[model samples]
Target: MEQASSNHTLQAEIDALKASLQQTNSQLEEAQYRLEEANDMIEAIRSGEVDALVVKGEDGHQLYTLKSSNLAYRIFVEQMTTGAATLNRQGTILYCNSRFASILELPLEKVAGSVFCDLAVASEISNCNELMNAAWVHSGLKRELNLITSSGKEVPVLLSLQAMQLEEGLFMSVIVTDLTDQKKQQQLLKEKNIALQEAQETARELNANLEQTVRERTKELYSNQERLSRILETMAEGVEIIDTNGHLTYANLMAQKILGITQSETDDHVYIDPKWQAFHVNGSPLPENEHPMAIAMTSGKSVYDFEIGMQAPDRERFYISINAAPIRDEQGTIIGSIGTFTDVTHRRKSIQQKDDFISVASHELRTPIATLKASLQLLGRMKENPDPVMLHRLIDQSNKSLNKVSVLVNDLLDTKKMSEGQLQLNKTCFSVAVLVNDCCQHIRATGNYEITYEGDKDIMVEADMDKIDQVLVNLVNNAVKYAAASKQIKVRVVREGKFAKINVVDGGPGIPQDRLSNLFERYYRVDTKDNHYSGLGLGLYISAEIIQKHGGKIGVESKLGEGSTFWFTIPLA
Candidate 1:
């Protein structure tokens, strides 16, 4: 039995030894597996796959970050513009970049230990927690929320949460984007849109009123046109409008009168109508293209002060000064031409008369000057050995020449005085008959003609005696010079009403009827049959002025073959 028990104990011991060996084998296997795991972790750390390791220490759990990942990753996380942070499972901040710390208005060290939810806005704490739970389940989740800063101000942020499972612990990475500037931009855009809508409404209102404004303007334009039409009708100058086709579309009253066209005939009238004869100032034919209106239309330029002559049917030729301008559209295209014309007939006639007077005055002055020069030369030659009769003849010739010059000079002076309205008259009571007789005394002494006085001899008048004598002398002289064929001149004075009428009758060739009207005009002279009259044309004009100054009238009566009578009347005493 001792042997068996010992054997059994040995067998039990063997069994125990087997069990021990099995446990040792299991322990060895586990040691080998752990060794493999450690090697793998070391490999992972070396390869920079593991960032940190969690170790249980005497105090608490601690994180030991591997230096293998080094400064590069830390620099990348810290330099991010978006707030970058790592959080623990309990929402406690483990690592935070400067940007993340700046968002919470806290230092980087302070942010690292702080609970992330504590910084969240009180109203959004639940939402943030929900987002965090969702992020833990889904790995990557995005949410928008507000966080309270260190100063208790709310800051809007967009959070991108990404949960990571590590061998040590569960961690979350958060990317925060600031939304304050973006919200401000959205609000500003909304304001601009509202302003644009208001402006569009104002524009619609202006468009609605545009038609009414246009209608009012049209009415005002019509009223102005009517007023302009009335003004055109009353204007002294002629106004005519021509169409592009060169037909007269409109003509004012003065235009029709000047052009000698009736209103009915205006429809057929053109600027270059054949019936309307146009001439230049020099009496040359004016071509159609040279007309003022034609030039204005063709060249689109104004023609001012263009003097043109036209002869209407059964009317005398007349001059007209034309001012023409082209009518244009808004785009400056020539539409037609408008011309204003003024009748310049009297001005033209005066210019011609002035030219003629210059020629005549020069001729008349030369003759007396030559005669006086010759008489003086003769008197000088006979001075050495003087024959009394020859000397007396020369003296008489000089005196007569001087008297002629004096008369010519006096006439020029009197004409200038009358033109300027500076003629001074000395009035006295004088007998008209006596003045006529005395005026004829010199002619009677010459015995060149027989002078007779008729009518009332005692006719008296209030007049400038010298001026009256001058008028009478001029008439008697003209009778003597012009009526040399008939040697009789009758001077008559008569009283009719409150005036005395004097007449100087002659048997000269009567002036033509056509020339009678202008006889009293300045520089007008009657064309005698002989055309040998030596006096200036100013005699009749001066005589008329003198009689007019005495408040009298002067006129002439003549028949083709019945001689001529010149007469004047002044107020009687």
Candidate 2:
């Protein structure tokens, strides 16, 4: 019995040992399964498949939690105007935003699985791959590349890449910016620069040719002394010869006409005669010693390009550019001097106009460009964490600046067309009243001024409708600008015989009488100390040209203290 009991005890011990072993093995399997589940959860979180993670404590209560940022990141990607995408280490697209798909003109699903390098042009594919490789070492890379769109059109883009290490694998985030508009602007600036260089070269060549011509003519005069009289008579420029004693020896017919001199006065020393009174370019009385002929004779040196205003015998004041050189006889003794005069009143006026145009254009373009630059800089700073309202305001401001730039460009083009006598007119029959009201609507909406209209509602005219509208808008805008304090503007349309008359009347400080006649001149602006007004000063000039082309007229009436009225008359249709 004792042996049997000992055997049973041994068996019971073995069975207990086996049961403990089986329990331990089952616990091990469960632990392994839980570990696998935990790893899967981590992977799901990394892949953005899981949004939240919960941990339970010994009390079966949550101890720690983690939330995914995938939603916020996706929203940010969607909001970006620039294209964004993610690619694998091998340059295969793994993810992409709507903007990226739009740029390629393909569906997002199609783009996500496609090779990024394949989307680039054949010539750019190698470079694209190289750029991707460089991104791994440099952390980021940027390049300009041409991408082939779905339609097979090559589009230029600025591509930027940044390497990212994720739980799943390594990836590269790419940002693509369309370079179409930027390229266009760059091309325009380049063309302008080239044109400017060409113009400068042409001006230099003209000056050189002019100087050479003058030198050649001087040599010819000395070599062919016998034919001097005949040469002087046939020359286009006015020529005169004066002795060293200041007595006039000879004067060509052209010289007589230019100086408004009689046949008898041709023999007199006009330089020393007070009756010939001349003024400096600044309108100061010119001294006899400072005259080109007087200076050349007394100093025995050439005087070139001395511009002065002269009171002709007809009492009319005109500008002349004079060049004089001392003449020497065979013995090398100073004998006399020869002088030539070129009428330069028109040329001086043209130069002044050109200078004014450049000044005005620079000022006009600078303001909008500065505004645009500032807006863009501010927008860039706020892009990462932007307030929706403020972002909208910034965008609106930028749009306004762009519009101003567009308007300035259009005005410049129109001015160029006017200069080339190529300003086209597209005419149509339109009601004058409707046109005037439509033009003023935008200005009136600003609530800065009270606009009043009085006219025959049925008055119709045949003219370039858009051009007329532009003129009307310009007039109203000026009225509002100058009469802001007065706060009132009146527009009137009336029928006078065979013409329809339109007037823009403003209640403001009236223009001076001296400035009235020059109102329609190109680049002419009223002198003002106030900095509120700015423009290229081409509006009135363009308006006048448009009216004249339609066989009409434009004018302004003003009194210093009262008010002003700008009016135009177009032939009735």
Candidate 3:
């Protein structure tokens, strides 16, 4: 009976174990089905179906993500909690990561659709429409724009504006970051810089006080200052002071005169010394930047006498012998630069005129002396000529040529007197028309060439009779000399409103094209064979000066093959 009861108990125990096993299998099957559903959902979302995966949390009835592997979506969602911004198409506010909204003192909801400009950001893209239009027209562009928040605060943001051809038309993605805190910190630091500046100011004040006391204690200041000030103001040379910033601090009378700048004009003004003062032959700014005497003081390089020239609008080209030295206090620290300059322009001009006179005198004297010598030789060779009349004619021609030489010499002497301010024009009312006819008649008498005249009627002008005669003679002689080989030399005088125009036209070879511009410059001779073979080329220059002195203009017009005309105009009485 005991064995039977034991077997019954064992059977009951086995039956209970089987029931527990079945329950475990059922739970396992349910778990497998749920996992398969989750996998299916993830696959669907990834295969162009949805944006995310949903799952249940560890606690009962709590929801969570079973799997989230979409990095772009993850970043987009995370941006709502971060300061980084994730933008969508059309530049709409897609997502401001939490950190970003915090930077702007705004909520995510308030910032949505705020756009970049709604915030008070002063960015380069204040004109976003123009930029977007350009981008769409061109396809892709990247630029930086400042961001504004709902709180009317501005923040610097680097924006990458991109265009993509999406299935839903054009799309752009803007990635932004806030630099407000950084800028604020920088501003705060910049404000704090006053301490450093004040310290420097204090140091400067202390040094200045110390220098004042030291100079006074030494008892040499009054004497030195008096000497310096007197020398600066009364020195024979001009003087100027330029602060380290290249500002005009002080200018002496001579300096003002040389540069044509008065104290009134240059007071407290930023002065830029002409560039020629700094450049050398090799196109380098002399003494370098640190060598601009004021600069040399800071850099410890010595500067010596420097020569410079400046051209003014008044046609005053001033040449200055310059000396620049560092201006220092008693402590010997460079404060600025003091430059001494003298007006050497007049001196230079005088020297040049002297040189020009010598050159012209020598050149003019050479040919006449040569002709006289040649004539003497020829006359000597013909001393025993068979024809007395022919010999007499030769002597007469030689004498006439000699008379011309003497006249030119006299004219040179007169020019010297005029340059020395001794010659004066005897102003009178004379008829330019009469003078023109006289010149025509004279040219005709001397030369067998056809010389025609126009406007022979008396048209009076205000000029010295001799000066008018001189002008006409020079022009007619030049015409005769140049047109000796031509068929006709025409002199035309016309009365225009308030001025009378005189023209000497020659059908001979016109001036060379290149020689027309410099016809008035002294000693400027054309390289043409005909020009070289003619009388000295002083006629035009002398005529030009005389005409200009009379308030008239002289010019020439000619082409390569066309005949040339020399013309002048004078004011009518």
Candidate 4:
């Protein structure tokens, strides 16, 4: 029974083992069939044969579907205006659109499988490599670079690269765009800027030239104005310019001096003011309207030799002669007036003196002529039966009259010669003491006064002896005539340093202070109402001239009540 039981157990074990092996073979066949179906499905999907798939899960039955959309994507990329391409991770061109091949001037077959970096210009290959490396980390990379076409031409292009990750490997999608139009526009803009700069430079040069010309012209005008001002200042006559309104517009240096107006005091309106005191030639008060410049302006005519007396601000009077003429414009219309002034005080005085001298000389000549005629008539009467003593007295009277006439003629001749600067002197070394004593002897013989001589006995001087004698005689005669009441005359000579001084003192009513300054002037005399003096008033004048010719000075000292002393000094020998 034990053997039979063991056999059954073995048989059971075999049966079980067979059943397990059959189950393992069935599982292997199902795995093989499923893998074949999976591969076949993949192939069908790629070939566009299968369109749908179904998968069952715990939630429910799920349907998964596949569509041939790559055709649409391929069409879109092929028809794009921009070039499109695909690059492997190694930067090799694996696939490219028709537009990409057209841009590079190459066939699509040739563009694919070519190194993308090799298609770029040699200088831009490094840029392309950098772009490809950036594409691995970044989603998109872009750069502007030049591409080398199949014809060996360099064309500028904009390249865009994008990174795509797939189970096969990492790929880069590249897009290229032509940059020819953009470069042309930039070149045009640069040319326009250069042209603008050139135009600005030309304008600056023109402005500089214009400024230089203006400066030159202004400098020339200033120089001319300065020259005109110098000419006006150097003129001798007092010139004044007035406007039509009688206002002084311009005055030279001489004009300011003549008018007694200082530079600080002169103003535009001062010369035309009517407040100044002015007189006409006839001693009547002159009105403003009658002024030379004013009359010239109003009448439009010249006024010549219009004399007027003007009192300066210091109250000193001046005799002025003016000649004024209207200054006319180019149209002949009076615009202003110009006047010239001359001081004529001395000239007028000289004319008056000549008139007075003529009158006095006529009277003097008449008196001498009357005396001579009386003497001649008496001689004629005595011609019949004249007593000798009476005839001698008449002849003596005639001789005295002739001497008086001869002295008068000589005095007149001396005066004329002195005025003409032709008076000649015969000079010698002479004793001043002798000159004084001789002059006093004549005066003492007249017995009009007690004449005395004092001082050095032998004072010698270098002078015209005859002229000195004449001067001494005149002084003594004057003392006798004027101081006869006092009956005293003194003649003195002294050596003062290098000079010999002579003095003639008289006890006479002293000269008036007002008449002292005029004592030495030609033709001047002390006019007394009583007519106590006679003869021409040329004695003192001639005396002064003679002393001056001898290199001497003559002067007087006197008081109204005290006596008069006339003195002179000459260089001692």
lDDT of each: 0.76, 0.74, 0.58, 0.71
Q: Which tens-of-lDDT digit does each residue in 1-573 have in candidate 3?
A: 899999999999999999999999999999999999977876674443654322223443221221232232323223121144433434455444455565577875566445544453555445675665566556435455566655676667554444544333454444444444445443332343454355334323323332233222222422344323432443345666666787777777767776777788777444455532433323344544633445544653434334445544546345655545555556666566655555555545545655666666676677767777877787788778646886777777778778778866766665556545465777788877667666556557755777677774677888777876777777767766666677687778888778888888888667777678888765455546434533445666777777877888888888766778888888888
Candidate 4 weakest lDDT stretch, 10 residues: 206-215
* lDDT-superior candidate, 1 or 3: 1
Models, CA RMSD each: 38.6, 33.3, 28.6, 45.2
Residue pairs clashing, model 4: none
Q: Compared with the true structure, what per-residue lDDT tens digits does model 4 show for residues 1-573?
A: 999999999999999999999999999999999999987885574343664333334565333342333232333345334577766666666556676787789987677657788999898899878877877798656789898999998888887766755334566767777675556543433454465355334323322322222222323323344323433454445777777776776777888888877666555554446657788866798888898888977886666668888876555677777767666654566767767676766655656677888887887777777888998999899899998998898888888678667767777999988876789988889887777666556456766578777997888888888888888887777776666676878888888898988999988888888778898888787778864566677888999999998888999888877878999888898
lDDT of 1: 0.76
On TM-score, the candidate that comes out on top is 1
Model 2 agreement with the true structure over 102-123: per-residue lDDT tens digits: 7899986567557799999999
Candidate 3, residue 378: lDDT: 77
Name the weakest run of 10 consecutive residues (lDDT summed) in model 1.
Answer: 209-218
- After superposition, candidate 3 runs with Cα above 4 Å error: 1-318, 328-337, 381-397, 416-437, 440-449, 456-467, 479-488, 497-500, 506-573
Residue-level lDDT of model 1, residues 440-539, one tens digit each, is 6878998878988898777778889999889999988888876777789988777879988888898877767787788898888776565757877999
TM-score of each: 0.58, 0.54, 0.40, 0.54
Provide the clash count, candidate 2. Answer: 0
